[model samples]
Target: MRSERPFSVFVDEFDAFASPAFATFLNKGRSSDFMIHLAHQTLSDLNRVSPDFMGQIMGNMNVRYIFRQDSQPDLGKPAKTR
Candidate 1:
């Protein structure tokens, strides 16, 4: 089933699939109705899928989210941080 609103798809360990279908979907169907979210542990994971594919995949992503693994996440926060 599908919807008019964009649905977010989170793919964990992106290299495991190694399916070109994903590349085609993200490339040709880059619209609001469907969106793909990809995550990988390391650069090697993506490399395993093919460098060219990786580049094209990365380019398809409009937003980038990053996280930090510090000892204490709130340690350096200033007054009344959420």
Candidate 2:
């Protein structure tokens, strides 16, 4: 099944539901008029799948927003050094 008009899909808790096919769609969806919005709590959630897949997801994302998070690593902060 497919839509004739452009469409969008919102996937929340993306890491819990992501698959190799999603990686493919992220790479190819734009031209096909498909937009996918993925939301997750942390990169660690995606990393649990595979670092390579996580990299794929991050690389394909054109926009990202980081809300308040407790972990410094999630905010791309370097760990404190003495």
Please report how far candidate 2 places residue 30 from its true position, in Å: 1.4
- RMSD of every prediction: 8.6, 5.6
Residue clash pairs of candidate 2: none
| TM-score, every prediction | 0.64, 0.76
Q: What is the lDDT of residue 40 in candidate 1?
A: 64
lDDT per residue (tens digit) for residues 1-82 in model 2: 3469988889998988988778997899877878889988877777677767777787787777667667656556212111
Cα lDDT over the full model 2: 0.75
Top lDDT: which candidate number?
Answer: 2
TM-score of 1: 0.64
Which residue window of length 10 is worst by lDDT in model 2?
73-82
lDDT of 2 at 9: 89
Q: Per-residue CA lDDT of candidate 1, range 1-82, in tens? A: 4576777778887778756677887776665477778776544455566756656666677775546424353334222222
